[model samples]
Target: MVGFYNSLYNLAHTHLNDTYELLTSLQGRLSPAQTTTLMQSTSWDEIIFVSQRSPRKSSPGLDGLPYEILDILIRVPCFHGLILTSQPVRFGSCYRC
Candidate 1:
């Protein structure tokens, strides 16, 4: 049991390190125009709900809304949008939460 947990921890660390390296390489390879386009296409609106309490305050004209409700309202749509993107979420033996 201890061995299994240790192995999982090590695997998670290795995966995170590999991800960081890959992202760093990808960042270096992007052109200024491509970076600008990427930034423009990415949604900042979703961030407002995640980082703030109210989605109404995010866009204006709203009520006493909890972040949990705001997540259901906007965050689910953002997740579905990500699923429809070029690089969809991979679900398999490769990654586990």
Candidate 2:
């Protein structure tokens, strides 16, 4: 059991490092127009539209929050504010991030 976990961790770590290197090599290759489009802030309508288009109950995330739940949660003012500020909620911390 322990060996399985260790091997899994090692495989994930190696893959992530390789993926990071590949992405790093592609840096500064974007056109000026592409960079401008990527840098633009996403609008609320865009976010809501994406959420609506996503699968509702078929694939829940690790946190078990489905797109439907997420869609509803984001509609609330407080959660909406958190999303806008980009402050993710830590498991038990008030504001670690």
Best by TM-score: 2
Candidate 2 local lDDT, 7-94, one digit each (tens): 8878556777788899888967889999999999878888788888898675434556678777877777667766655555667865
Off by over 4 Å in 2: 1-28, 58-64, 94-97
Per-residue CA lDDT of model 1 for 7-95, tens digit only, reads: 88785567777878888777548788887988775455555544465444353223444555545544555454532342433546231
Q: Pick the candidate with the highest lDDT.
A: 2
TM-score of 2: 0.55
- Model 2 worst lDDT run, 10 consecutive residues: 56-65
Each candidate's clash count:
0, 0
Question: How close is every model to the real structure, measured as TM-score?
Answer: 0.24, 0.55
Model 1, global lDDT: 0.53
